[model samples]
Target: MHIHKLPDDVLHGILQHSCYFQYPDFYKWKRLLLLLSICKRWRHLAIPLVYNRVYLSYYDQSEDTSIVDDEPVETIKGAKTKTNLDLFVINNCASLARYADIRILFTSNAFKGLNQTIERMKSVLKTWSGIKTLSLTLVNDVYFVEHQVTAELYDAAQINQLTKELYNLIPGILNLRLKGSRLDRTNKHLYGKLAGYYNNQLKQLSSRHAIGLSDNIYFAQISKLDILLNSENGYKLSQMCTTSLVHLNIRGVPVNYRWASFKTNNDVEQIVFPHLKTFNISYLSSTPSVDRTGTELYNNGRLKIHFPVLTKLHLWSPLGHCELLASAIFPEKMDTFDVLGSSKTMQVLSNMRIPQVKKLYLNVASTTSNIRHATLQLINKILENSPGSKKNKLIIHEDSIQIDPAVIEWSQLTLLHIGAQINMDIALKVIAKLPNVDELTFYNFVAENIPEEAFALKNTSGCHNKLEALNSSITKLMLGHNELGHSKDAVITVIKYLSVRLESLSLFGAQVAFDTDMSEFVNDYSHIYPNLTNVTFRLLTAKVL
Candidate 1:
């Protein structure tokens, strides 16, 4: 029967059987063997086992491919044949998969002539028009062919011709990952030709070309983009700005400059991605590559580039020269924001005008003894800077962190988390302040940390019932453990008043996403907290251990 005629469930079964999981497992091996079998049994067997997923490699355990270095296509005089050859070949007698991986390993003169080899490879590649995701790798090796020291891989003209041929073979390819070699000899021509062949089916693209992701592929229709940032690029971000882009990931080691010694701020006017939503900037190296100081990224108020629709921004561990990158693009205003960065890194953004946000997470990372002080100070700065978002429901991200409720807008906060450094007086003050909190989490919640005002009275007055006077609107409460360990009884005593109005509470655990609208984050983390249904709604006092 024709492929489209297959029932939906049967087609899904075919895809499930052909998909490649971790390496080549039993199912993959069986499928490969069944593909090679020429008996009548093959008549009833599914053809998708071979055509649904394909991995063509030369330096692998399966598949046959050759790699060569071609810079304008040069030929060394007098090729020698004295070299050890390692080979793996899989002939493609039929067309293959929705996902295809081709790793070309160029060998010595032992392989067929360039013309013959490329023709053969092209023939095999021609059958894979169904591929939606394709990963292409080119491997160049230097060998002693009779001590000639040959590094010649293949003719560039031939490879370019092959790439042109591949246009028809993989026209439906949507996701393309290119590594080791540039796909186009003329660069833009081949990429543009491929884009035309696929009819803009390619939405996501990544490259590890020798020069990085610079000047490799150009297609304005691209929705997701990954850029290789280095000192050489020095922040001409306009080249990457496309109105269709929804996500952007920038990362790379400095090619010729160290961030510690390099001083160059981004050209703020060079970026204006109008429809972009998520922007991430980080480094891919062993050394910590953050800018030397906040001043390094400051442009002295030159031009303000804006991302009109940007919502999610994440700056991971190390940023070589991409520090405060969002500040360059997300200038004065943006709606529905999610920002994650250090206190020092975020200090400059304290005045960003965010009218509203769906989620806001701050790491407040520090190596000092007063992390609580830094965390509180940063939170206050953010709340002061973002008046519009002070009333928006949001979720916070941090494995373990503290908070100061002094500057917070109580009614808008859906989640409240405090650390060991909080005073009992301040903790009780939070209960009185939170008139609309849906969830509350406390880490290192020991009684000694609470001031006497919570359980004591004036020397001349009666015992103050401050704990019972609490009016918290919290629905879910989570009590987390501390690194140094805390007295359980002390924690129970402190949370009893806060839990008075809780609908469901989980002790010694945290649900980072609570019950808010960030469904993706919440769904994965909802199971982290222990049994909440079993917990009786009685004031968490003298609670079952």
Candidate 2:
């Protein structure tokens, strides 16, 4: 039977599954439009899915057109007629007023007549009354525009007017994001107006290089706040007033010792975030030198900031900055700690004590030899200091360290994800050690500097035997990255030796050549794994058979 002849429920499910509204891409939208053009029933089922989230952007159509006559026609006329995103949204999809999310993007050099563009944006916002989330991005040019000055900057007053109109039109908006617009201290009046309107209803706020807050603003129900910190107008932690905030992410903030001093005041003793639970800080500057000899630095010094209920902490900063922040704000009871950076951060994390940490993600930068060595050292220290009661799950990315079987407590590990390029021999040895791992993931399996005999089935006396005798607790295996085609022999050997009763297998980014038949390979391997029932491939490429 044809797809359109199916039941309403089935058709609706198919349309929902195929819609790409969440991912704002031109090709995806074209595909959705094609699907809608199939038939009336398909259009009826797919309309809501396609209009659930709308992204409007200024698309330059000048390159798509060719000049046929010797006399030059004005490009502005074509731009207005063909590249208008606001007109497309209002003319084509304005009937779907219940769109949950709306994103408006303006390229710095694309639009003409700034005031007209703003008016068009205001009209678009007024047309959509049921939007729960709104995102505005004004992309800046790499160099200054010389010819037409209208596209260089967005007027502060115009932006404020647009924001006020949005708030008045969509009072129930729960999430708001503003990005790439230049608003410095001059925009304090805008913030004052927004603070009054969004204080009670907005639940999440994220901004990048836009809307600098010069005065204190209170968010009554705001729980998650993400901001890209700039030197001029970045919000100070002490200036924010919120009682329900639980997740806070601050990025692009220059790291200096003075950040710890932000909390120190002669009048106020301590600034407290009573209910915050998750704090993430990243993209710290590395130009400043830190004093590592001072013993008082580790005790948080005179800085008095308290995260009374903080449990999950993620730090993506330079080694010195991570150490400095951890020493000052390290909570007593952290449930999950994700340390992502170079070996400098790892070296500092190794010595730190967090006995309450149950789930640790070490995303260390291992591009250099020195960083790889430090990562290995950090892993050893983590295993050494791990508590014996709680079973820990570890995720290692970007580097593979040699595992010393004698020092690691293999039984304590529950899930291990190795998303890195590692020697095949080392991977086999590590798997043999982790007798209790239930799930294992390997990314970019590297088999360099290994003899062919190592993977040969005839070699019964080598480490292959240990791999064959490894424990049977593992049930899931995932292979990832683009190097899978080259490492097929090593992957097959590992699968043949591993005695675990596998239940699921996933291959991601596996490159299949025209000569290779993935179905036949799967059929051949299925007999070896009697319990394997679910097998999936993501981003698999091959010539048509």
lDDT of each: 0.46, 0.54
Error of 1 at 366 (Å): 3.9
- For candidate 2, give the lDDT of residue 258: 38
Residue-level lDDT of model 1, residues 1-545, one tens digit each, is 97757776786576556544744232354445554354433423444554455544443212222324421121222221111011112433345457656544543332223233334445445455666886765543433132332333334465456566676566677887755433322222233334345434668876544222233334557788665543323422223326678987766544122221121236433445677888775544445344433223334444344567777776553222234543355634454454444444455456455445545544433323344346555566665566665433433344344545565554556666554455456666666667767666555344456544423322222333422334655666665433145454444435433332233443333222122122332233223322233343323323221
Model 1 worst lDDT run, 10 consecutive residues: 80-89
RMSD of 2: 8.3
lDDT comparing candidate 2 with the true structure? 0.54
Per-model TM-score on C-alpha atoms: 0.54, 0.62
Clashing pairs in 1: 51-97, 64-89, 64-90, 66-105, 66-106, 67-105, 67-106, 68-153, 424-450, 424-451
Which pairs clash inside model 2? none
Q: Name the weakest run of 10 consecutive residues (lDDT summed) in model 2.
A: 73-82
RMSD of each: 12.2, 8.3
- TM-score, cand. 1 vs. native: 0.54
